[model samples]
Target: METILDKIIAKKREDIRNMTELTINDLDLSREKRSFIEKLRHTSEMAIISEFKRASPSKGIINANLNPAEQGALYESYGASAISVLTDVYFKGTFEDLKTVREAVNLPILCKDFMVERKQISHAKAAGADLILLIAAVHGKDALKELHEYAAELGLEVLVEIHDDEELEKAVSIGAELIGINNRNLKTFEVNLGTTEKLGPLVRQSGAFLISESGMKTREDVVRAAKAGANGILVGETFMSADNLKQTFRDFKVPLTVPQR
Candidate 1:
């Protein structure tokens, strides 16, 4: 039987096959851009990268009917530092979804997907993505380095994602400026926030900006991760599962707020 990752990769290959008309060279490289790294660096409040995730391999459909543009606007209005748009077809998201969010908000948008090929990076930039996620587990160090350089060439920032010490070393060796620690194990799909705690110091020692990804639900979770050295947090399920997304965002950032007179 095929694993969840196997299935997703298969589907991605099929999607690429269907887009034969749009070669890498056909991609529009001149979309006016916002700086994803700059937003993270300049953050004064809780540096939250709120995500527009409709489904997942583990949990299936999540807020399938929520409008991407409207939700993007709401997250921006509530002070999200950046936006993450899942563009995987298996996740029930499309490039159109990402583009819609980009048109809807001025904040930097990360094209969150299982990106493996240069064509995908080109498509991301063409769709108004300000950044792309490069998972260390998926491509390993060599390929990850190559993809990171290719994305930078297209004027797209890369969030080099790692899960453990080995991956963290690879990211550091590559001189990755933005590194993300994913708490969820891709092989088992099990989430453990302690993953960030374990890898946080290594990332800090590498002198890269750190983003803690997955398994963050409450303000306390954010605090714990920050205390461990995460400079930013990429939160998805928490905000997506909230009945009131705006209020949930406010609550998550409460500690970062100053008292009103």
Candidate 2:
């Protein structure tokens, strides 16, 4: 019995395979893809790429009408390093979500979707996406390598997401500059913050920028991740699901008291 994740991923793979009929090489490239990569490279601050995720498998709809654009604008105003928009429609997001963030903020907007082929690349590029995520677990090494090269050619920065060593090695081998270490096992949706603490260093050693994803609910988690050499943190559920989203995000930055040193 294939789970919802399995079904969605399979359908996506088929869509990508079907995309061959359109002749990917002949498809025109959008200018926004190149511009988006420029903005991300310029935001040198070590800050959160705050995500506006509506729902997740572990928790039901957190905010059905949260208005991603408005929320993203607010996040940018509050000093978010960047914005993350989930473009997986079945999981509570779409290209519109990416556009919403794009229109509302000057900060970079990363399209958090299961990108399989180049067609979606043009879609995301046209929709105002500044960056695109390419999950290593979903694609074979060859496919990821091809997509990564294509994305670079399109002028989009690729966030190569890896869950473990196998994928991490592949990500490094492909010369990915941005590495996202996802703590959640998409196969079972089980999260272990330790994954970030565990693999982040090895990824950094390979020369890619590092980020910690999932299982982060508190400032301690942020500090722990930062100590692990994470260049940035991608936070969504804890902030968006809180009763007071603004305050929850703010609390992560409250200064810790120290005995007179």
Candidate 3:
């Protein structure tokens, strides 16, 4: 029986077969990529990496009517440090969404997909991605390292994701500068902010910028993650499901008042 991750990989391989229409050399590697790392480094407003996800396997068809370009523009105008464009077809996304978002916003764009091959990195560049996400759980340590290096060679930064301690070690060993501690379990789909807090110390020791991903729904959640040493946060559903996207972002931007002891 194939798991969700397994199904996604099989589909990615199928996508690669169709990618023969364009070769690596055919891609314009020199296209100026905005610096995703630099944007994260310079931000002081909780470093929100807002994601534009039309849908997901877990939650189908979030906002099918949403215009990618318009959403991207709104995210930028509301002070998102960077934008994440979901490019996985399984999740109702396309590379065109990333390209459209890139054209609409000045912020760096992250290609959020289950990357399995070198060609996927090329595809990201072709689609105007400045960064790409690599889940440590799916690729393992060796493959993750290779993909990370490949993305860098193409001038794309990487956001290496880890869901547990073992995966955290792999990311640190690879010298991943941008590390995302996912609060949601891929297998069970259970979410807990404690994942970030528990893994926070190891991440700090590795000297990597910590990005807490998933389940961040309010100003309080942001404060909790920050107290755990997360330098950035990747929020999606909370902001995407909002009727007032700008006001939603404004709410996230407000500083949290930590309770005094």
Candidate 4:
């Protein structure tokens, strides 16, 4: 059965074919690169990576009127470790959103998209993104290795996202220093915080920076993730829908009880 991920990847392939070539010179390499992992490592609290997202396949039209620049600034002022901007068409996002956020905030920006090719990474870097997301379920091991290496060569951090133990093994095998355990399964769109409970220890024991992604809402959710061994948490809908952005962000900044190995 074809899942939403399949549709997104299919659309990405089509978009990739139409994209123009972008070289290293086309990007602003002189801009100081902020380390996303370093921020997580040094933080005593569960690092919050706030997202500037407009929509998603499961929950469409989250906040269509959201201004990326303003939201990015808010996240920064509220002590977000980093800012993530959705750059996928299906999500009603564009690379322009990322550029706008980059111009507004000094925080490390993650270009949240269904990245398949190196060209996409080039586009991300050109748009002022310091990091890119590579879903483990999207590519074969060899293909993922190539993309990871290519992103490193371009001076961008790769957040390798995984759903299960199989994907986690693949991420580990590739020497991925930043591993994101997404509670929401991309194929089924089902969310379970237990996914983090099951995978977090393994990721932490591997000595990688473990991040619990998706379905994080209240302070309890943040605590659960932290206790499960997450150095950071990637939050989107909760922040987007919050009436008081600053308070909500601050509330989620719970301390990590688990020691980092």
- TM-score, cand. 3 vs. native: 0.92
Candidates, ranked, lDDT: 4, 3, 1, 2
Cα deviation at 226, candidate 2, in Å, is 0.9
Would you estimate the TM-scores of all the predictions?
A: 0.92, 0.85, 0.92, 0.98
Better by TM-score, candidate 3 or 1? 3
Task: Please list the residue runs of candidate 3 whose C-alpha ends up more than 4 Å from where it truly belongs after superposition.
Answer: 21-24, 254-261
Error of 2 at 8 (Å): 2.6
Report the C-alpha lDDT of model 2 over 162-258, residue by residue, as the tens digit. 9999999999989998899998888888989899889977987887778789888887887777767677778888878677767766755532221
Candidate 3 lDDT trough over 10 residues, lowest sum: 252-261
Of 1 and 2, the candidate ahead on lDDT is 1
Show the lowest summed lDDT stretch of 10 residues, model 4.
22-31
Q: Candidate 4: lDDT of 137?
A: 97
> Whole-model lDDT for model 4 versus the true structure?
0.92
User: How many backbone clashes does every candidate have?
Assistant: 0, 0, 0, 0
Each model's lDDT comes to: 0.84, 0.77, 0.85, 0.92
Clashing pairs in 2: none
Tens digits of per-residue lDDT for model 1, 123-210: 8888889999998877777888899998888888999999988888899888899999999887778999999888887788778888
**For candidate 4, lDDT tens digit of each residue in 17-123?**
98988888787777798989878767788888899888999999999887888889889999999999999998899999999999999999999999999899999
